[model samples]
Target: MNKRILTALLLAAALVVSLVGCSSQTGGSKPVEDAKTQFKSEMKFYGSTTLAPVISQLSTSFNEHYVTWDKVDSKFDKKDIAIYVSGAGSSAGVKSIIDGVSDFGMVSRKVTDEEKAKIEGYQEFKLGMDALTISVNPKNQLTKLKDSLTTEEIKKIFAGEFKTWNDVDPSLPKTEIVVVTRDIGGGAHEVFQKAIMGDTKVRADVIQAPSMGALVTKIIENENAIGYASYGMVNQNKGKLVPFKVDGIESTSENILNGTYKVSRPLIVLRKGDMLPQEKAFMDYVVSDEGMDVIEKLGFVPNK
Candidate 1:
């Protein structure tokens, strides 16, 4: 062979070897990532306005950390681990999962047996703890009269048996007690009814706020209003409202975690059948220490 031609052929061989080595190193995980993406690229969650904040924040963090979701499987090139979350209500959340419309349903209360039986493969993941905090407007005079109420008294007030502040206690005032609550289908409302009202029904005339934030605002805006809301929601709005003690126990984190508080419930996620790879990755992250940090930061008690 000519000397120049031989040198050119040698250079070409070296280039081929280098290219092969590079491909082997980088392309190893490509097939795995592609397989993972086929299982799921985007995840959707709906239900529980109360749990929405936690999921929404977690989704943002998940997207940032898992540009390639190596948590559930081998890393691949950037797959859009798009996590979509919405909060309609807890009942709506359960229905969404059963109907196959949502990847997961966020529920702030326990799932009833009936709901569980409706689907073929119902699964739940408990994320954290929250309580129903009975709150009154900051300007309400009942706080001066008493900071705590017996379970019986609270029940009567919600049941419409105690129609006025004076009815609750003569020294309080003659003002008609305005009962406020989250509209039906909310986890907060269900928790409140089970813990306080029990067999008794809530007043027909009760003011129903559509969302936790709205319910908080209603309590703050109406001096005569008394309502129950998520402990985290009320805790976040501390100065804007006043939370009452139930049966003499304050709704503190320590009290809630210890089960000393009567009104608390679990924060949960629901899905049907097996989770896709992306769903598994997102859920794994959700229960991780970092995920628990998000729960704690939001004023809810982490299960850990």
Candidate 2:
């Protein structure tokens, strides 16, 4: 074969070998407690909102196999894992851990100095990057938006100062915008406040949803609803939800990686920078190429 063809064949062979090696090395859900165990002790975990999807997958995969512990009742030798993920806001998760309510807390934004001081034996680690996406329902005809609205303008719209869509843009329809927002305790709330609302509280007329799932549901149901969600949650969507450009930049991995997505935030799995062997392994798995595969599929930007 020609040199070019020969190189391509060699590369293909190498890829196949690499894939096979990974397949054989990976042990899916068999008891790992007894085999080269790295954990000093078995443990359970609960995580926060922004980290919910990734953490849940990690927890489930971890739980499938025993980790340094035998099954309590080994008659059937059922899975003896204890990791559980509770979908709460980042603030709630941090508070829970600080108050001794959970094993760990997850947050997309950096923990504040005041918050850092509150957790006694706590620490945080960044997992990846995520962007906050602005969205509107499908039926709304207003398409063009300013590259980036001022923080004041964003607050005013949510606060009901700009009551109708046309109020902000006279060329748009006069439909009353039904603003949907995250619950008060949500991490999204924190980011939105700091990035776009300054310190102002959400307007009274804004509809608050308990979770991102609910927020999406409400937005989809109400053609007039305008809301925000993590790029991961809504990027895969089609026409039911329309994500607007932020400062003329699309919230894609490309834009985020290049530092153009203004709202991109890091996703962290907190457990102190130094991890126990098991924790280290789990964290590594998450940021690893395979782990990033999951993140990408979920519509979030992977860490550069």
Q: How far in Å is the alpha carbon of 22 misplaced in model 2? A: 54
Which residue segments of model 2 deviate by more than 4 Å? Answer: 1-42, 63-79, 144-153, 272-277
Query: What local lDDT does model 2 show for residue 128?
Result: 73
Local distance difference test, per candidate? Answer: 0.86, 0.70
lDDT of 2 by residue, 1-304 (tens): 7999999999999999987777666853344466544434444344456578777776665556444233322332233455567777777776776776665677777678887788775677666788777777777766544534544556788778899988878888888889998886677877777777776777786888887778888888988888877777786565678777765677777887676777667787655334554455556666777777777777777764
Sum up the clashes in candidate 1: 0
At residue 238, what lDDT does model 1 achieve?
69
Candidate 1, poorest ten consecutive residues by summed lDDT: 28-37
Candidate 1 local lDDT, 36-136, one digit each (tens): 44545678999998999899999888777656555446753345667888989898999998898988999988899999998778888999899988888
RMSD of each: 9.4, 19.7
Best by TM-score: 1
